[model samples]
Target: MKGFLEDANYSIGLLDEGATLADIIDNCIYEHTHTGKRAFYVGDLGKLVKKNTQWQNVMAPIKPFYPVKCNSTPGVLEILGTLGIGFACSNKSEMVLVQDLGISPENIIYTSPCKQASQIKYAAKTGINIMTCDSDIELKKIARSHPNAKLLLHIATEDITADEEMNMKFGTTLKNCRHLMECAKEFGIQIVGVKFHISSTCKDLQTYIHAISDARCVFDMAEEFGFKMNILDIGGGFTGSELQLEEVNHVIRPLLDVYFPKESGVNVIAEPGCYYVSSAFTLAVNIIAKKTECDKLLPSGVEQARDDEPVFTYYINDGVYGSFASKLSEKLNTTPEVHKKYKEDEPLFTSSLWGPSCDELDQIVENCLLPELSVGDWLIFANMGSGTLGEQSTFNDYQRPLIYYMMSFSDWDEMQDAGIASDTLMKNFFFVPSCIQLGSEDRFSTAA
Candidate 1:
């Protein structure tokens, strides 16, 4: 137990051996039942420490620079910062956040694809020199705003991805690499290395093989222009799976050793956004309204057979306009596990989850199977910290959810062992329950 912590971003609960995520959730739900039910996110900062260790073990030589766009939660940033992880920021605000955390400018890279000129100038003012550029226009933009900027030329990947629409080429083609290099030389911009963009959703491991090979070609081309390139950033495609990590490492490790060997002095790094924080967060949304329809037409206008099966529609406190914002871009197959206890033999009904906005497009989970739910019952969605709650604009002002950060004492000890200053974390937070509101001066409890 310690003094209370009050932060706009979140209040963390340092869990002891007996406390569990389940205990915290139950306590949060119990408090909300007496007060008002609201949607909130529970982040396990311990998971981040484990993920960092996993990255070190599997992708050792290749350093990880976490992309801020994945999830910019304050707690995430704080823990990652303390773990000695570098950052890959996309915009000014992200830079400001990392800067606020006292991260050095050299440890940050501005990787925004379409960077605003103002942001470039801001980076220059702040002494952040590394940024990525793909085209002549972007190169010029960077050259004009940040004359001393160290650049990583972004190149298009040859491998196709699952979403054909997102597959539209972004980075400059390899053939055009010389042209960009020429431009960089003319502008006197320092080309430090090449960057290959790969999304985490792409399961194909061949993408890494091809992308790394292409990057080697880029490195050789840069040499022709007298540019001493050293960094090869295989941009963020990590899915947080240990199996996938090993698979990717197996494919690229040999290639890296052969192409940009240890003697080459080329620093290889990666942008792992979701890999560190995805599984660390859980979102809990309360059922605000419920509707039961028997043999009625669903949203697809498909009429169900008169099999006497019931369909349920549940309206939750948060929706597309809030915590489930990522639903707009990708299909979320997250089926929530009900928090309330139920009979094993209970009949499960066809169900759909909707957000509070009531906008037709605000549907969170299109269809799921669950036992009949009441208005006050809570549903838990796991692995939610991967960018669902990013960009504050989408949230309805009244419905914005708060975050509760938690980590087991053993994990905290491990983080301290991993070189993070334990005293640095002391002032950030003390201890408190997730949903309970305590005065700043109140003595905080480690109870889950």
Candidate 2:
């Protein structure tokens, strides 16, 4: 634990014998509010959009259509609505939400490739007239249901990835793309454009260029068949984190300049879900349990949870079941770096971190490097949840914590005379409630 403290850059006081984990959470919550501490803070989407000027500068040449599935929180959607960016809705429910939010119908591209007939009909009925299709069957289904609908031909590429497999389920292979375009002509349906994706976490620079080249070929095929394909819906997979945006731009910008000829009368569109929301927040969790054991070579190789002779365990209130379960299920090697507040100099070791859930598989870190940890400690989970820690709240049956937009200086002045700060002040900011303490019986039962 001494090593964990120093490595995390947190100062550790003498352990209090009577203290419990819940006590730590309560104290932290109070301290966060009073001292204006934020457990998670969403990056300002609007500000980011403004700074990058993506819609105006970078994404201008390549039109951006926001994918609502990434975050879709009201706050997120409202901002996109204000930006006048088009939306990529996969279902009727999303269309309904778009309508409720008063998004313009012209700004919606119903991009669900494998869609129910009712969803298709509702899209046509609700006036969300644009959609995507990859197969002759799905094309036929839409044409039969909404005969007069405007459809975009979906093209498959080996480039992009996302949480959902967009290409496998709905996109047409290059040969199939030509076939689908011919099918569109047969069904008397208008094919307005084509779409593709650079799969999530794409590691190559040529991925975008290759996809655009493929799209151009599809466009040329449509032209050969006397179809006027004006829109190219390059489906969402734009990198979201500002940390990676520069790298993304390096990989993407040149591709756009190369294949996108202004004379072609084709408008490039992208469905960027994470790009709009990934850097928006952080998560702070209370440490529930800390254990140390000596171990040799362990199967998991986690210093904390080694199956060897020695192992250490640090339990947090949240875990895979609640906050990051889907990501874990995918066996993705990506893990959040722990933000240390205690000891920064402690030796980091391979350790396992578990969620507070009773399920044995409920864990956050399978094997990670950390100094050590003790009970009643607070740690930060960066990029928590789907789009910061705001994505999945109440996952472990924990109630959603209050989201506070830390006051700016101007707003602070407005309430300065009200004693809002003074009233919320506390001697110590780290405390948790006593009612939810982890009992020995609970731990023992789970181990069995």
Candidate 3:
């Protein structure tokens, strides 16, 4: 264990010095006898901070409220909290999680349109009065349970070009908005704002323009009802892509200027889930087994070998039931890259990657070309921080991948200079130990 600690420390030192991810993985494997099946690089949390800074620069008037459901990795949440980003929680448990991180109730927005009676009571008791509703029935429930609640009517905006359309599940139509508002008035509930989601992976910037236009119509109606609506909740659909976000800002900024100008005294906030954490994580999986179809024999007493093409199947430890759950839930197609590179002339074979589970549906990738790989080879997948970590379960009693928390050396220095205790930060916000301490004397020593 002591020897492994020394090795981990060396690898972390390299990472602090900005070593390549592939090099860090190689070093980790060499040092730790019990290297886990999958590893998460928490240092990439810096990327999320940078993204948020970019968002602030592009949309200075708009505030971002991170949806905790996207990737509730403690380290990710900790970094986001440190950056002073607000949170959008969907349920009572989610609300509790954010509050436990020392976030105040005012910093949370309950974005889930549907809620159980008990959950509504809990929110009210916890001072989380800012909530969302889409139907008359929900409004009535909120009125009976928490009449003083401030509400944002969720409007469903369909985006024909979105990869996932959320309109099917939630959002109130413009025609129904006035009725819901009137119902809120009858029940003495406050209608504070309007909210809409174009759905995840939304590609149409025009959808925002249309949604905002529709929201304006509702805003005017609220005025006629003698309600002062001060908030506009632009529900999340940002994809974290620089070009796509820039395009969205380019179109929506001008529209907001015209319709919901700063002088209008309206506060604009967004529920961005994937935008903050999507590219901030990297997953590393190790090949545990390999089989070549060409090595098998046919029933007709003929070998399956083919001179023209060779097919291979590789098995990895993490599967669809675990870290890859997003593939099914989010329709994400993950592409793996081998850690080591081969020469251009090196022969490659058609390959399919599968999880270690017995279920045949646990395939990762199919009909891809990769150089002939052996067991113990490492495969890295990027853009894994969103909707991946929090969904992992211990199905079949298989342990989930171990995560290693880290930050850029400069950020670490800055935090230290600010007198932030690493122990407190890890204990309060991160479930995993810091990579800097994981393989150091602090981890193994019995006393200070």
The candidate 1 region of ten consecutive residues with least summed lDDT is 1-10
List per-candidate RMSD values in Å.
Answer: 4.4, 11.6, 5.0
Report the C-alpha lDDT of model 1 over 1-448, residue by residue, as the tens digit.
2111124345467766766788777766665676678777778888999998899999997888999988887788888898888999999989998999899998999998899999999999999999998999999999999999999999998666557566456798999899998998899999999999777667778888889889999999888999998899998878899998999899999999999999999999999988998899888889989887853446566766677688899999988877777788877746699999999999998899998876898998878889998998999999888877467544456466657778878787787676684565655555543334333232233333
Model 2 regions more than 4 Å off: 1-28, 31-47, 51-55, 160-170, 241-259, 289-310, 329-340, 347-349, 385-402, 405-448
TM-score to true structure, per model: 0.91, 0.70, 0.86
Q: Could you tell me the lDDT of residue 257 within candidate 3? A: 89
Least lDDT summed over 10 consecutive residues: which range in candidate 3?
Answer: 1-10
lDDT leader: 1
Clashes of each: 0, 51, 0
Order the numbered candidates by TM-score, best leading. 1, 3, 2
- Those runs of model 1 whose alpha carbons end farther than 4 Å from true positions after fitting are 1-10, 166-169, 295-307, 394-398, 429-448
Whole-model lDDT per candidate: 0.82, 0.59, 0.73
Poorest lDDT segment (10 consecutive residues) of candidate 2: 1-10
Please give the distance, in angstroms, between residue 286's alpha carbon in candidate 3 and its true position after superposition.
1.9
Residue 177 of model 2 has an lDDT of 77
